[model samples]
Target: MTQAQTGLPDVNAVGLGAPFGWLAGGWRDFTKAVGPCLIYGALLVAASLGLTAALYHAGAIRVLFVVAAGFMLVAPILAMGLYQTGRMLERGERPRVGDILFVKSAIRQDLFILGFALFLVYSVWVEMAHLVYGLSTHKFHKTLPEFVHFMLADPEGHNMVMTGTIIGGIIAFLAFSLVVVSAPMLLNTKSNVFVATLTSLRTVATNFLPMLLWGIMIVALTVLGIVTGFVGLIVTFPVIGLASWRAYRDLVPSSEGDVAAAAG
Candidate 1:
């Protein structure tokens, strides 16, 4: 793979099942480093539970849906530890809980830039969700059951769901294209967020079908994690995180020679 004028290493084309292949690679890493990886996943589950409880107690039951979908926007950053675990494994080094938690490269400014950008996108998603929900219903449901009934029994809720899905999917896919490669690249390479994001965009643009399938699988698995009361996230999150690192490596240059040789 050659580094083009745009600074992106040539992206690889994979089969539609590439995402699953990544997940399988992730699972292998997870098993190899079960203790640290499971600990990391458990931490994510805790955070998920904490957020769901806080939102529920705050009587923002209407927003549970938003939170579930919006989780994708910030999940890349959250998956940093998983990426670290995968990276360490790739180097034939054993990873520990401490290594995953306090990764040295993760503290860089470029990652901060990416994180802030993700935060901005997440904020926009929240506001857009509010607007869509408000337009859909005048009444704010206070409980999960009430919200479920409103969505299932009312036409307004149905329209809102459809509209919100379309809008959210667009925003989420854009966010995914920006982060899917960049987040891991920033950690793995000396690249800045700009280059990282550009490469990420290029990867998706050049391989749209595979990228689309990857995005769908990510969202579907995330929804599955949320629906299972965050319990599923204990495994799903880590698997996705580890798998994401695999995806980044697959689509971009992993070694200095890979980029330099391509540049030549």
Candidate 2:
């Protein structure tokens, strides 16, 4: 049966260690275009730092977890430039500052649609965070430390924690499934939002184990970036971005004609 008929997109079977290879390839790409890649990384870090500061100023530090999770919700759109860089590398060209900054080819109607859909998902999560917090805890803490104590020690807070974690986990997985491959597909190909999204879901279904490992790696590095006060993101952000591109490259097959054209 053909892939199209079976409704399973053509995807490579990735090994358990495949994500690490992608990371290594990503590191190489980062070094190959160190200046531009670092600048891209810095931009991501700056944004993260800005959000953190805003949260602190708003005295909503307790919601920082929601914010961080929301950051991941939109991260694929943020990494379009990095995907372009990977494309350039694959085409036997050095990544340029302009390519890393403005991916002209990736700017299309479908990309916008994908972005808007992700934004909607993020908005829903934000609203759900409010509901979850309300249903989870009896009182909101005024200080960050107090919130931490409530989350860790209070009996009512424990219930909130359980409920929030369960609901948030599902939301996170849904976001991951929706964007993991579709975002890169939109950036790299002529696929529409619906096709890209369906393909992404199929890829996940067909390769659940490796994809789970990949998702875990992404979350771990992101948490590390947050724990380091967003400093580690200077490296982690671009690394993950580039590595995601590699993942897309590995999973999706190229058209033979396109491959031949590139070779020519």
Candidate 3:
């Protein structure tokens, strides 16, 4: 049976399995791959900071709520460019920094799907956070220091935080389940979106443990990026992007035969 029959995508088709030497290679490659993404990320940070500064200067911190709404409205569309850039790098091609400007043709439908999924995930996360806090309200009230301080100090509150975190994590996992393989699959093939999403969900369900570990590593690295004020994202984003392509290569079955059939 061909690799496609075995349900594995081509590892070498994208040149994604380069040895560690070529995978990250040096700071130069990292800079090349990540520079464009960093600039985009920086733009996002600047917009957010500008809004925050304007609100603070005006003594209207409450305006941050509207600013946050604007952020959510725009972030998913920007995320499409980020993922597409990663795909280009995975294929061992140099994407121009301005290539993201052609966002009109790239993954528009998938971005909408991803955004809706994220909304559901965030809603669930918020609900869980509120539930945990509500449960601990009495304890927080009776404790020394204020509610926020008490939550930070108590073991039970810590457990609540852990519970809320896990709940949010599960939602995120579910949201990604519908898209992880589908994103690349859609990029590579002319398959229908529903079929692509179904295939992706099946791929994740069948390959649960490794994908779960991959998800965990992504979260950890993202947190590290945030903690480091996004400077680390300059390296982490491209590395992880390349790594994701490799992971998808390892996970998804080859489609050579299908491609040949379609060409004919």
Candidate 4:
């Protein structure tokens, strides 16, 4: 039966090591347009740092955990420029600063819809974090180091971290499954948000291991970037974005017939 007959989208499965290959591909793309890519990454990092400082200024350092997780939720929208860079590089065309920055092609209704969905998901994440902290009100972290020690060294705080991690992981994965392919796909195709998100979910289910590895790699690299005072994001952010574009391109087939070819 054809992919349409079987009621499946045109997607492919890959080995677990495929994500690493995608990362390598991203690095190549980055080198081809380092200046533009790095500039794009810097803009993102600046926003992140600004928001973080705002939170600190507001005496809400305790909710930094939620903010961090929320980044994973909304990051796809932030990486649109990087996706454009990848697209240009794939065409053997040099990416210009204005091309990636303005990204005139990305100004579409479907992309806005996708961004809205991510925003909703992020809102839910924030509410959940508030609930978690509200459950245990005995301790309040007024600073970063205090929050770290509370989460790492205290028993109740450890439990709270575990709970938040488990819950946040589930929500984060849902966001990832929805956006992994759909975000970049919507940028490149005329697909509606519903079809694009469905394809993203199906792609994740079909390539669980590789996608899992990919998710781990994303978190690891992002944490690495964050640890370096958000400096490393100048490189890691675009690499992950470029690699994610590669991942989406690899998982989604261009032709309906390719599904059968992949199944074979």
Query: Per-residue CA lDDT of candidate 4, range 1-264, in tens?
Result: 456785545789899999999999999889989999888989888988998898888988876667876787888888988888887777678889998899765798889989998888888889988888778557677888888888788887878888888888889999999999998877655467888899899999989888988998998998899888888999999999999988887998766443332222
lDDT of 4: 0.84
Best by lDDT: 1
* Position 135, candidate 1: lDDT: 90
* RMSD to truth, every model: 3.0, 2.3, 6.4, 4.0
Worst 10 residues of 2 by lDDT: 255-264
How many angstroms is residue 242 displaced in model 1 relative to the true structure, after the best TM-score fit?
A: 0.9
Q: After superposition, how far is residue 139 of candidate 4 from its true place, in Å?
A: 2.8
Model 1, poorest ten-residue lDDT window? Answer: 255-264
List clashing residue pairs in candidate 4. none
Which one wins by TM-score: 3 or 4?
4
- Cα lDDT for residue 200, candidate 1: 91
Residues 1-264, model 1: lDDT tens digits: 466554666677778888889989988988999999888888888988898899998998867778877888999988888888887888788999999998777898999999999889988999999999889988978888999998899999899889988999899999999999998877754577898898899999988999999999988888888889888888888889999999988887556743452233
Q: 1 or 2: which has the higher lDDT?
A: 1
| Clash pairs, model 1 backbone | none
Query: Which pairs in model 3 have colliding backbones?
Result: 7-253, 8-252, 8-253, 8-254, 9-252, 9-253, 9-254
Error (Å) of candidate 1 at residue 65 is 2.1
- The runs of at least 3 residues in candidate 2 whose Cα sits more than 4 Å from the true structure, single-residue gaps closed, are 3-9, 257-264
TM-score order of candidates, top first: 1, 4, 2, 3
lDDT (Cα) of model 1: 0.85
